[model samples]
Target: MSINHTLKTQPVTPAHVQQEVKLAQRNLANSTPKENTTPEKGTDVKLSALTQHIKADSPRDIDMERVEKIKDAIRNGELKMDYDKIAQALLQNILDDR
Candidate 1:
């Protein structure tokens, strides 16, 4: 899980670290930049001719059941999940149950 960085050789100087930080920030910025338009616009522009609506729900009841379990865990203190952890766990639970 360890990732290589500029620090693999000499200790990172302020300039080197700053450059790395900027590059990383740029990468993060690029990753989440807003799409120019919604998918609904694609067909109208002929950029894409076809589309399918995604069903945004699990196929199994177990997903919802797991959510109830996790919510109960939080409410009853069987587990304490932070905001990020709770969101992650919510996704994981859906996948797990699915």
Candidate 2:
């Protein structure tokens, strides 16, 4: 199967170009500046509370000591994988999705 499409093009003259320029200038002259808005006091308070809660609940820095211990364990082949615990956790996650 094949499809054929045709496009129509307009020839631009000096008058056409001048008209476009005048239209653009008219639009610019008619444009107005938007008004600035301030949030209500209650909204500002709620936003600040949310920001503080987020900061408090999230970890700000990594525990370097714990990371080093895990790295050391891996290097010494002492890091053990508890397959049963992992499988149970995975299954619980799957069931929780329902």
Candidate 3:
């Protein structure tokens, strides 16, 4: 048996496709093994990266509000990232991941 397919890496959006293309270009430039593609904080894809505001309508973008709320929480002493909660959530995620 034989199988062949070409997987062309492409952007997931139209408005921000250019950014994805640029990231792809950078990815090609800094090509490495799949295991090593993600290097570090500055080099890796993060949750915050997924929080981009695509629409101009503020109400449409929940991430923007969430980000703002998080910043406000930090500023107003209303937010608390307990390690226990983090651990629990991580555990839940690991369980759910399976």
Residue pairs in clash, model 2: none
Tens digits of lDDT, candidate 1, 16-91? 8899999999999989969685665444442333332233344773688889899999899898647998899899
TM-score of the candidate numbered 3?
0.31
Residue pairs whose backbone atoms clash in candidate 3: none
The lDDT of each candidate is 0.74, 0.83, 0.77
Evaluate residue 94 in candidate 1 and report its C-alpha lDDT on the 0 to 100 scale: 98
Q: Sort all candidates by TM-score, best to worst.
A: 2, 3, 1
Candidate achieving higher TM-score, 1 or 3: 3
Which residue ranges in model 2 land beyond 4 Å of their true spot?
1-51, 56-61
> Per-residue lDDT for 1-98 in model 2, tens only?
43676577887679889999999998887786546957656643445776777677555467878999999999999999999999999999999999
On lDDT, the stronger of 2 and 3 is: 2
Q: What is candidate 3's lDDT per residue for 1-89, written digit by digit as tens?
A: 43676677875677588789999999997886566456566666545533554423576546787898899999999998799989999
Candidate 2, number of clashes? 0
Best candidate, lDDT: 2
After superposition, which runs of candidate 1 have C-alpha atoms over 4 Å from their true positions?
1-62, 80-98
